[model samples]
Target: MIKRILLALASGALFAVGLVVSGMTQPAKVMGFLNVAGIVDPARFGPWDPSLVFVMGGALLLMLLAFALTPPSRQHPERKPWLADKFELPTRRDIDSRLLLGAALFGIGWGLVGYCPGPALASLLTGGLDAGVFVLAMLVGMALARRWIGRVAA
Candidate 1:
């Protein structure tokens, strides 16, 4: 249990560092990336930031490498890396009303705040009031969702 806790903490710290280094913790950078129409530019194709693309590309490359290294069917526990044992490939889900609603909500939040969950948490380190408020609101939203979903299911 202690080992798991330590590992979780270390992983979170590493993730936060990566967000900061990648400039994902900055709302302006994220907003710039989202300006696909380049309305904020005089060149008409300007104001488009490619930093998010490169960051995502690097992440995808790492994921591909990990997937290649750990085939799903490999049963040689002794030879497999820890990730092979710890993580499973996610199964696909069909588009449903819930999924659509969730996606819409996420997109709306991202566009409005320019900070997803991970980057929002990372931004807390900078002691920014906006980040703090966003994080607090997010937690409340999550809790409300949990309760509402539970009631509906029950």
Candidate 2:
């Protein structure tokens, strides 16, 4: 348990640092990078930022490596995670209305504010008002979504 907690802390700190260093904590940078439509139009390409492409690509590569490396805990008890006893993975593979609504909401929020939950929380260390407000709003939205999605799913 202690090892797992420590590993989680270390992982979170590293993620926060990556968010800051990758310019993800900056709303303008994120907004610029998210402007994919502008990239297709030469006239509107000025606001588009391509720097984030590398960051996302590296993340995807790392995730692919990790997923490919990890095996089923049931058949590989000796190869379980170093920090935890077992993997707590999602077994559900089928997509539902809940998944669609959640993804839509996430994309809308990111496009409008350029602050996903990770970067928004990481930006709080810089004492930015926008990040603070965004985090607050995100929390409230999460609460509302919990109750709302529950009803919808039922």
Candidate 3:
């Protein structure tokens, strides 16, 4: 258990460092990336930021490598390394109204705040009020979602 906890902490620290290094912790950089109109008209909307694309590409590459590295499961022989085991994998019924609603809400929040959960937590290290607020709000939102979702599922 302690080893798992330490590994999780290390993983989180690495992720936070990556977010900061990749410039994902900055709202302006993220907003710039989300500026689709800026792609066509840099003068009007400002230059389109491709920072996120590179960051995502790097992440995808790493994920592929991780998937390649993980050994195949014995019980669920057909399952891909990247995917959950047969018992853990969600069914089509799991993709319900709540899932769609949550995804839409997450996208809207990301667009408006320019900080997803990972970057928001990483930005906390900068000691910025905005980042602090965002992180707090994110935690609160997560707690609320857990409560609500648990109740709904029950």
Candidate 4:
């Protein structure tokens, strides 16, 4: 349990660092970029704020490096434990109303909040009263849904 707590804290810290470094913490910047205003005020930053491109490139590069460094899984390992497992795609083909409704709800929430689940949690940790409310409401919604599902299943 202690190990899990430590791991969660470490992961949260890493995510917070990523959010800060990526400028996701700044809603104004994201909103401004979305607005597409023609002002282009380069004077404010003065060549220092290459936040967007650098963040994306760095993430992609890191992912590439990780994939390259990791060796391919072997079916029959020379060691005790086998490295490979059976792989298969989802067999469910039906696009039920639940999936569409969930997607629509998620989109509506995101459009209104400007903070998705991960970033909302990050913002709550980093400091945002709005984010705190959002997280609480999100948890309530999740709990309600789970209760409803349990009742239905029962």
lDDT of 2 by residue, 1-154 (tens): 7877888999999999999999999999999998887777848566578999999999999988886786657667545564556768899999987789789989999999999999999999977999999999999988998898799779
Candidate 4, 3-76: lDDT as tens digits: 65787798779978898767776655544434333246546633233455667788899978765665545652
Give the higher-lDDT candidate: 1 or 2: 2
The digit string of per-residue lDDT tens for model 1 on 1-154 reads 6776788899899889999999999998998888787855638766788779999999899978875776444466433445335545568767888889989999999988899999999999977999999999999999999999999889
Q: Residue 143's C-alpha lDDT in candidate 2? A: 96
* Cα error of candidate 2 at position 47, Å: 3.7
lDDT of 3 by residue, 1-154 (tens): 6765787799899999999999999999999999989989999889999878999999999988886777667775653533334335555665768878989999999899899988988888976899999888888999999998899889
lDDT of 2: 0.88
Pitting candidate 1 against candidate 2, the one with the higher TM-score is 2
Pairs with backbone N, CA or C atoms under 3 Å apart (clashes), candidate 3: none
Global lDDT scores for all candidate models = 0.85, 0.88, 0.85, 0.68
Ranking by lDDT: 2, 3, 1, 4
Q: List ranges where model 3 is wrong by over 4 Å.
A: 72-94, 143-154
Quote the RMSD, in angstroms, for model 3: 3.5
Model 2 — which ten-residue stretch has the worst lDDT?
A: 75-84
| Highest lDDT model number | 2
RMSD of 2: 2.9
